[model samples]
Each structure stands twice: as structure tokens, then as C-alpha cells.
Target: MATEKLDVEKSSVELSSSVSDINLYTLHEERAGRLVVDPEEAKIEFGEAIASKLKLSHDGTKVLWPQPTDSPNDPQNWSEGRKTLHLLIITLAAIVPDFDSGIGIASLFQLAAQYNTTTEEINNLTSNWSIFLLGPGGMIAVMLMRRYGRLPVLFWSQIFALGFLIGCTFAPDLNTFAAMRCLTAVFGTAPQVSGLYIVTDLYPFHRQARMVNLWTMGFIVSPFLSPFLFGFLVARENWRWSYGIGSMYGAVVCLLIAFFMEETKYDRGVKDVPEPQSGLRYRIETLVGITGFRMAKYRASWKEAVMSQLNIVWRPHILGILIFEGVLFGFGIGMNVTNAVFLGSPPPLGFDWTPYAIAGGYGTPIVATVMGELIGRYLNDWIMNKSIKRNNGVFEAENRLWACYLAVVLDVAGLVLLGASIQKHLSPAGLIFGWGIAQSGVMICTVAVYAYCNNCFPRYAGEVSALINMARTMGGFAVAYYQVPWAEKNGALQTFGCEAAIVAGLFFLIVPLLQVKGRSLRAKFSL
Candidate 1:
């Protein structure tokens, strides 16, 4: 989809501008290529050396010589089963680190009690996980999406995450456990890119918001079941079982991927191209990923593709979304996690698992999230369609962003209530009920904002998504360190309430028609 749109904008001059990976730039007509070229021509004169090479679909879908004329290059044109496989692969790759975040916190007290260590030491594990999942991990993943196939990268990451989980299970010391968590964050976070990336790959540009929301649901699902499992295990078998369960779950997901998932990284409906050129070291690694330069018809060196990938990393829109989601979602969500700890602990604020963990997280918020996702997956499509029609069908990307209004409303309201609820330290039911609103509101934000960011780029969805994760992960990291201390110092109520109001206020200001001038107030998120 990206290549097709780009080719449309590519004047003859841009092709020369892209001349670096010249080898991959040219493709030979072969099996896929030949059949592609001759829709009506029964066995054209190539009689002897039935030339071999993949070709881009004609009508400019970014392939090489001898390709189909009408190929759409949109992943949606693939089989229904293929789409499902793509989503599954992403869920497998993306869900682990996220599940570990909120779920793992409950196990901290148990872990420290067993080792006779302090909670502060255990907190490092969260830091390591956060940094890898959203920071350096995201930056690294951006390269992989362009260099390696999306499916391969996603598949490998899940398998690696399984390995890390296993390592965590067998850890002899806190350091060892911490190390495994970090490693998993690096490898396992690959699929998170897929969540936003696939919307562009598989759906029509106008149809993207709902799909992005659906992927967020996949992410939300893992956490729904994760905390319960964590609390149950840590309370019964000790904290190690928490790691064991995650590892086992990851292993099962990896197997599912190996068996059912298909490689979606290929440019659907198009022949591959010679990638834009780049440096020597980058090319060498690209060769390995491009399969020893085996996919020669496309003429892309591992090096050129990497450069193309890097180009995406630096885009302002991608950076904006990553920063926005990573920080805002991370800030709000991370605060929710830490505050839950503070609010639930014994004291005038005496709280327990039944209300906090089970009722709030597992009950009200879970149900609300499910409802929100259903809206995202199904009803949201209808909303987008209506917006498009009202716009006279020009279909700017901003048309799809209105769903953010709901999220903004909930986020502000929840933050305000949460801030006040803390000082009140109400009964468990009262506290959790208010907290549930915050959790659900954040999920709403995650679903809508994520869709908005990913859809911002019809092309380079993977890169855009990667940037978003980086920002979100970094935000979570900052929150992991600062939110609680800030809340504690600032009259927990005063500071949190004020921050919540600010976020809500900002969301309202940005929630209008999606752009100011040509600049796009939401940046490139203009429908």
C-alpha cells in the first residue's frame, strides 16, 4: 500500500533520486512475474528460459518488470484467513511485555518477601521492561520492520519472548530475572509495531480507524486475564510461577504463530523493488534479512531497505504520534498502575485485592474496555463511513479522528475523580469504582489515539507504529519513576487532580476538526 501511493507521487526525477540500491531496482520476469504480465496472453513468446523473478503489479503498484495491471497492493485483497493470521501473529508478538506490566506489580511484594529484599529493588524489573518495550526496543524494531519481513520479525520476536520468559522462570537471582525481562522486551516487543502497521497493510485508508481499534483490543485482552493469573499464582505457588505462567503462555503463542500465521511483510499485489540506497554496513545486514540477496528480482540490498526504514523513523508525524501515545497513555496508565498500589495498600487507605485487582481491573474496567473495543471494531466503522459521506467523499485522514472525543471526555473526567478519590481514600468499592473509570478511560484513549497515529501514514504504517510505541514506552518509563513521587509530594489529590484536568483540557482543545491550518493540528492525523 505504501509503495503504491509513493509511486503515484514519484515523478521520473524521484526514481533517479532513489538510485542507490540500483541492483534491486531492476527485476527479471519469471514465474510470478510472467504469469503477472500475461493476464490475456496465453504463453507469450518467452518459450525458452521462462524468465524468473517477481514483478510489481502494473497500474503502478511498485513492482518490477512484467506484473499485473490491476493488482491493488492492499493487504485486504488477500484471503480472509490471511488477515486473521496477520492479526494473530501481531497479538503473539505484542502482548507479552504489556501483559507483564500491570500484572507483574502484584507479584512484587511476594517476590521481595521471598528474597527478603525491598520493593525498590523489585521495581527495577518494571523499569527494564518499560525501557525495552517502548524506548530503545521501539527504535530497534523500526529498523527490523523495513529490513526483515514484518511477519518474520514478528514471529521471531514472539519466539524470543518465550525464551526470555523461560529464562525468567529459571532465574537464580533477582538480577537474572531482571535480565530476562529486558531481553524479552527487546525481542518480544516487535509485534506491537504490527498492531498499527497492519491497519495500513490490510484495510482501505478510509477504513483504518476501526481496524486500529481492533488491534488495541487484542492488546487489552492479554491484560484482562494476566493480572488474575498473576495474583492467583503469586498467592499460591510463589512469585516464580508468575514468570512460569507467562513463559508457558508465550510458548503456546509462538507455536500458534509457527503453524497458522503467514508472512505479511511482502508488498501485497505488487512486485518488490530495488530499495532506496544506503551505507555499506547497513546493506550487509539487509542481505541476511533479504535472504542472502536471494530475493534478487526485487533488487533491494539489505542496506537500501534499511535506509528506507530509517527514513520513516525520522518523520515528524511518526515522531509526534509516538511521543503523544507513549507519553500520554504511558503517563496516565502508568500513574493508574502505581496509584493502584498506593491506594490499595493498608492504612486509612487500606485496600485489598478483591476490590482493587478483581473488582476494578478485572470487573468494571474490563467490561468497559470490551465494550469500547466492540465499538472500535464494528460500530466505529459506521461512524467513519458517515463522516466520510458528510465530507463529500474527499476523505481526508482527519475524518476518522472524531472518536477521540469520547476518549477525551472519559480521560478528563476520570483523572479528576481519581485525584479526589485518593485523598478521600473511600471504601474499597468506592475507590475501585472511581479507579475503574480512569482505567477504562485510558483504554479508550489507547484504542482511539493508537488508531489515529497508525492511520496517519497510509504508507510506512510499521514505522509510524514503532515510533508511537517508543513514545508510549518512554512515557511509561517516566511515569514508572516519577508519577508516584510527584503525586505523593503534591498532596496526591492536588497534583493528580490538576494533571488530570490538564490532560482532559488538552484533549478537548485538540478534539475539534483534526487540524488547524495546513499544518494539521493533530499533525498528519488530519483524516
Candidate 2:
């Protein structure tokens, strides 16, 4: 009887050891540097002893990234409904800045006339300035976010943004209005930068691409949607009405954020932190910025915060993505800013489209954006999943670059079509179709690059967000300065054709370089 009992114990011990041998969770830290994981190896049989040792996805097929603790306060552990609500609120907030910036697009002529300035001057002083400020604003916001916490910085910044926007609605001169516009952009950038942080906070790696696509839809769609809706409004009412209505929208966003958005600044690194409070205390602390103050000791110092943003730019993959994404995104911005001028200018110089027609035409990009979102929502994940499976469940960040090939083709074709159609004064349908195609490419490019950068440097998520925002805004800033003059001087065909060639050449050169050598570059310059 004793011998039989011992034999049973030995069998049980061997089974447990075998199950443990298949456990990939122990290798997470070692493989994290390369973002390489074997999800198949991570799978554990139901009721295995090792199963209790790690957190798995809902289906129990893979281990979760940035593993959540047992505490319900972890954003990763939040209920689905709560997470969805938070995402919705963040999405809405993210739309406000660019939406406000774009509201002026349809009213540029009226704005210039009212302020006794040329449209070029108005574009330079207000629109271009505001766009340029977005990059610096994101940098400052992220610095504060690192030290002060996400919710506080976002809440307070939006409050100030609302104030500045109201000033924009009432400014009496071009100088005042331009100043207000710049200030609004500076304050409004919080949501744009914070959107990435919150998404990273709430979702694991496998789930981030889809959430990012959803969040990015809001960001990408807002600039176009504002012009479409407000184009009609400006036609019917005074141009100031657009800003007035924008202020009202800002008020609604503020209310949603104050009431619903929770503090997502939980430190997964700190093991000894106290459990978070519930109900009113949590609400007040987060809303008033006290939560950030309380936790500041564990956060990065001011010097470290500033340096972190600068240091991220030094990484090879990050630098490559910044330049690549920036240039493509710049062309998209150049097109958007130039579209109204191209279609609305008088006589032989332009299409002479009515405000209502321009508004309707904006729908082309809107539909294209939605289509891109729908495709990217699945496509990004599909690409990542396939790459993982093909590599025995190890995901390489460079794999994300494959999607950019499609973006390159769409962008080049769209730019060529847009340039030719405009230069030849082709039908409005041709121009709109080209615009839609280019806009779709922008959507795809933004998502793919964002996912790739984040995957490359998950620990530096905040800095990554800031740097990406900076690259995008600054690139647009430079292009907006030259797009109109270049188009007018060189003809739209030559200008856009050149732009398309740049996009193609840049992508073909940079993307392949990253794919073939990105891992080595990252390993060589690990930031």
C-alpha cells in the first residue's frame, strides 16, 4: 500500500512539471526586449496548476501583456462596460482639438475679409500657427502627464482649452483670434496625446491595435467632419457661429470627461502601492489633480520627463517611423488645407464651387475614412496575428510595416489622380475620388505606424505618443507653409506628382530597411 501511494505521488509530480515546462510566462521578461512571444507555448490546459499563476485572455488561449494584478482597481481588470464607456469618452475628447482647428477651414475667406487680411495671411497666422503649436503642446502635456498624472492634466487642460476656444469665438482682431487659436491648440492637445496612453492603460498588446483603430478613427475623422458640417453652417449663418457651436461642443466634452473619465495612471511597477479608493474620493482626487500629487513620488522627475521625450527620438526604429509617418501625414494635411483654396478660388485659378457643394464634397473623405477604419480595425490585427503564427507565435514589431505597402500604393495613386484632376480641371467626382483614396491611405498609415512604434517601445508609451504627435504636427506645419505656393507655381499636377513620388520613394526605401534590419537597429540602439 505504501509503495502504491508513493507511485501515485510521483506521477502527480511529473504531470505538474510537464505542464510547467510548457509555461511561457516565465520567459516573458527575457523575450520582452524583442517583443517576441510564443502564444501557442503560452497556452495551458484547463485547470492546470500553472494556469492560476498567470492571467490569460478571456478565451484562455494566451497570456496577457503587462499582466494585471488581482486588484479590481487595475484598469486592465475593469469590467467591459466600464472600459467601453471610458474609451467612448476619450474618443469624443480626442476629436475636439482638430475639429476646432478644422472649423476655420470653410470660413477662411469670411475670416480674412472680416479681419481685413488676405486668406494667405490668415492661414499662416492662425491655421498654420495652431497646427505647429500642436506638436509643442503635446510635448508639454506629456511632460506634465508623466509627473502630474493623466486625468488631471487632461481635465485641467480641457478646461483651459474651453476658455481659449471661447476667446477664439469672440476675438475682435486677427492677432487676438490667432493668439486664441494657438492657445486653444496648446491646451487641446492633451486629449490627442492622452488617447494613446489611456488605450495602452486599458488594453493588452493583442487588443491595442483594434482599440487604437477605433480611437484613431475619431482623431482622423474629426478634421474632415468639422469642415463638412460647418461648411453648411457657415453658408447659412455668420462665420462666428461655427466657433460658437464649437464652444458648445467643447462644453459637452468637458462634462463627459469630468463625470465619466477615471484615473488611468496606475503604476504596474509599484508593488506596494495602496489600493485605490472608491466612489466620491476617487472622483474628487482624480478630478482635482490630488491623485497625481499623491503619486508624484513614484513618477518621473521633471528632468527625466523632458529627457525621456528627447531620448525616444534617438532610437532607430522610432526615428525612422517618425520621419516616414511624418512625411506621409504631411501630404494629407497639405491636401486638406489646399482643397478649399483649389475649389473655392474665383475664375481660372479655381473650381468656383459653392460652400454647400464644398461641404458635400467633404463627404468623400468622410466615407473613405470610415472605410479605412473598418478595414484597418481588422487588417492590423490580422497582419499581426498572421506574422505571429508564421513565426511560431513570436511577433516582430517590423511585421507591422507590411501594412504600409498598401498605404504607399494608395497614397501614390491618389496623389497622382488628385494632381492630374485638379490641373486639368477634371470633373468634381475625379477630385473627390482621389481625395478619398489619399485620405484612406493616411488612415491606414497612421494606425500601422502608431502600432509599430508602441510595440517597439512599450515602456516608453507616453514619450512615444508625444514624439509621434510632434512629428505629425510639425510635418504638417512645414508642408502647409509650402503646399499652396508650390501648387500655384508648379501647377497642381507637378506639385502633387512630386508629392506622390516622395511618398513612394520614402516608403519603399524606409519600410524595407526597417523590415530587414529593424530588429538589429533596435537591438543596437535599445532605448
Clashes of each: 23, 0
Global lDDT scores for all candidate models:
0.56, 0.84
Best by lDDT: 2
Question: For residue 336, what is the lDDT in candidate 1?
Answer: 39
Segments of candidate 1 deviating more than 4 angstroms? 1-75, 125-132, 268-293, 296-322, 349-362, 508-514, 518-527
Cα misplacement distance, residue 69 of candidate 2 (Å) = 0.8
Q: lDDT per residue, candidate 2, 1-527, as tens digits?
A: 99999999999999788766643322333343354334445433334465456676888755687677677988999999999998999999989988989987978888988988888888888888888898899889999999888898989989999999999999999889999999999999888888888998899888998999988888888888888999999888899999999999999999988998888877766646766788898788878798788888887888998899778797777897798898898888777777888888864557889989888888888898899898888889899889888877567888888889888888889999998888889988889889999989999989998888888777677788888888888888888788778878878889889989988888887899999998898777765
Q: For candidate 1, write residues 1-527 as lDDT tens digits.
A: 99987777785456445443333211221121011223122113322123222333335322223222233433546666777676656665566766755455657676677667865566656543545455566556656666555555666667777787788777787777777777777777766766676655564444456666667666655554565556555656667777777877788777776655544444433445433234665444443354423443443455654565466555544444444455457655565356545644564432444423542354455666676676567546766556545644323444445666666666666666766666666565655556566556666667666655544444456655666666666666666666566665665577567667666655545545244331343343322
Model 1 weakest 10-residue run by lDDT: 25-34
Let me know the TM-score candidate 1 reaches against the reference structure.
Answer: 0.75
Count of backbone collisions in candidate 1: 23
